[model samples]
Target: MNDSEDGRVQQLCSHDEEHLITSGTRYSIKGFRFEPPYVLKRAAGHLCRGHVPVVLQLFFLTLSAVLLLAVLIKGQAGMADGETPFLVTVSSIANTQGQEQAKKEKVYKEMSQLKPQINHLCRPCRWDWTLFQGNCYYFSKFQQNWHDSVTACREVGAQLVVIKSDEEQSFLQQMSKEKGYAWMGLSDLKHENMWHWLDGSHLLFSFMKYWNKGEPNNAGEEDCAEFRDDGWNDAPCAVEKYWICKKSAMSCTKN
Candidate 1:
C-alpha cells in the first residue's frame, strides 16, 4: 500500500476503537462487535414508569391513615370535654330533686302531728296547762299533802285528777311518772275500805285493779290515793307529794 493510504486507514481504525470503548461495545472471538439493543433500554424505561403509581399509592394510603387517626382522637377529646359535663349536670339535677322530695315529706309529717292539737277545741290551752282529749291538765311543781293538794287545785277552778276511764288513768299515770309522785282525788277517809272520788262518785269495783299489789290494806291509816307510773298507791293523807289538777277545756262559742 502507499504511505498516505496506510496512514488514513490507521486513523479510521483508531477512531472506531475510541467509539467502541465510549459506547461500551463488546467484541467476540470472531472479531464481531456487540451492543445493547434499543428495545432493552426502552423496556427498562417502561419498568421505571410502572413503579411510579405504586409509590404514589403508598404515600396517599399512609396520609389517609394518619388523617383518620387524628379525627378519632379529636372526637374522643370532644366527648371528654363536652359530654362529660352534660352527664354530671343531669346527675346533679336528679340529686336536687331527691333532696327536695325528702324535705317535702318531712314537712308533711310535722304538719300532720300538729293537726290534732289544732282541731281539738276552738280555744287554746292556758299557759303551763296541756290539753288532751277535752280536758286540761296541770302538773304541779311543788309538793304538798293530799288534802292541801286538793285545796290547791280547787282554788284554781279545777280538781285533783279524777281518772274515770283507762285512757284518763293512763294519761295521768304517764304525767305523774314524768313529774315524780303526785296526789289523786281518791280517798277512804269517809269510810274505811270504801273509796270515793272528789267528784262524789264512788269508785267502781273494776277501777280497784289499778291499785298496786297488796295495797290499800289501810296500812298505818293510809287514807289517800296517789298516782304513780306503775299504778296507784295508798298513803297517809298528810304525806307531802306533787299533785295533778284537771279541768274541762273551755270551748269558744261561734256567733
Candidate 2:
C-alpha cells in the first residue's frame, strides 16, 4: 500500500489495541481473552462482600440444625434402649416394698387379733376367775354354809381354796377382807384342837400361826375355818358366808 494509507491503518490498529487493553477483554479475531487480574480481583471482592456472609450464615445455620437433630436423635435412641428397664426397676421396687408392707401390716393385724386368745390360753381360767401363782381362783358372790360351799365348788370342778404359803394366805386374807368373811377348807371337826383340810391334809403347827389372836378356842361349837382380813378364824359350820374356790391352771403344749 501507499505510505500514508499504511500509516493510517497502523494508527487505527494501535487505537483499537489500546481500547481493548483499557476496557475488559472482549471477543476478538484472536478469540476470547481474560480480564486484567485487578478487574477479576474487584469482581471477586464484590461477590465476597455481597454473598459470602449469607452463604456462611446459611452454612452455620445448617450445621447448627444438624447438630441439634443429631443430639435429639441420640437422646431418643438412648431412651429407647434404656428407659424401659429403668422404669420397670423402679416400679418393681415399689411393688415389692408395697407387698412387704402389706404383709407386715397383715401380720401385725393377725397378732393383734390373737393376743387376747393367747392370753386366755396361757392363763387357762374362766372369764370370772382370777389367775395367780399358777392357779385359778373364784370368789363366790352368794353366801353359803361350809358344807354347801364345798358342794358349790365341786359343781365347778374346783375346791375350797387351800392356803399353802404366806403369800397365798396374805392374798386370800386381803381378798376376804375386801369381800367380807369367806369359808375355807379347814376344820377341827374330826378331832378337838386338831385341824384338818377337806383334801385330807393334816394342819401343821406352822399353820397355827395363821389363826387369829386368841382364836381356835373352839368357842360355842365353832368347827369350820373362815378367812378374815387379819387371819383365819374358827366359826360355826352352819353359818352362811361367802366362799372361795380354786383349781390348777391348765397346761399348754405345742404339737
Candidate 3:
C-alpha cells in the first residue's frame, strides 16, 4: 500500500480492480475485493486517512466493467459473423478473411453442383472451349503450312495453341479428323533444337510427343512444325494448311 501522497491511481488492487491484460483486453478481477479496481485504491484505503476521491473510483471501476463487456460481446459477435458469407472488419483483430473465403468456396461449390446453364459454344483447337472435367480443349481442321496455320489462328482473335497438359495433347490428337498432320504452337527456329510454343512457353511439359519418323532433324527445308496423329514433324510455315487458334478466355465464353 505504498503510493504518492498527492492521490493518483496508477495501479489498482484489492486485491482487485479491472486489470488490462497483455492482450490489451480487460478482465474482471477475482479473489480480492477493493473499493476501486486499482492498486492506488487499496493504498488510499489502508495507508491514507482520507484524501481519496470516491467519484473517481466509481467512474474508473464502472468504465472498466463497461469496456470489458464490450470487448467480450464484440469477440463473440465477430466469431459468429465469420461463419457468414461476408465479413465486415472493424480492426485487424476481428478480421476473418480466411473464414469468409471458405464460406464463399462452400457456397460456390454447392451452387455449381445444381447444374450449369446449357452451353452454346464453338470448339476449335488444340484448345477445348468445352468445360469437361477441369480442362479445356481446342482442335484445328484446316491443314496449313506451320506459319500460315499460326497466322490463321491469330486472325480469329486467337493464337496458336500450346498444350499445357497430357490430357489436352491426347484430346487434340484424338480430335484431329485428318489423322494426317496439323500445326501446333511449338518450334525452335529462333533457337535451334530448343523448341518452344509461340507464347514462349518451354517444351518441358510435353507429355505425348507425336514426331513423325526420325524428323525435326532441322531438315533446314522444314522450319515450322506440326503434331501428326501420334507424333511430331517438321513442315513449312507458309504452306496453305489449316491452323489452330486459341481465343482469349474472356472471348472463349460460349455465346
After superposition, the stretches of candidate 3 with alpha carbons farther than 4 Å from their true spots are 1-141, 177-180, 205-209, 248-255
**What is the alpha-carbon lDDT for the whole of candidate 1?**
0.77
Query: TM-score for every candidate vs. truth?
Result: 0.52, 0.53, 0.42
Residue range 77-126, candidate 2, lDDT tens digits: 66656456679899999999999999999999999999987776554788
| Residues 51-86, model 3: lDDT tens digits | 456555546556655755676666566565545334
Error of 2 at 178 (Å): 0.9
Candidates 1 and 2, the one with greater TM-score: 2
Task: Give all candidate RMSDs, comma-separated.
Answer: 22.2, 21.9, 19.3
Judging by TM-score, tell me the better candidate of 1 and 3: 1
Q: Tell me how far the alpha carbon of residue 28 in candidate 3 is from the true structure, in angstroms, after superposition.
A: 99
- Worst lDDT 10-window in candidate 2: 27-36
Q: Tens digits of per-residue lDDT for model 1 on 1-255?
A: 577855664564345334433355543323323453444334333333333444443354355446545655665666656456679899999999999999999999999999987776475468899998899999998899998999999999999988889998888888888889999999999999889999999999989899888887788999999986699999999989999999999877654
User: Candidate 1's error at 229, in angstroms?
Assistant: 3.2
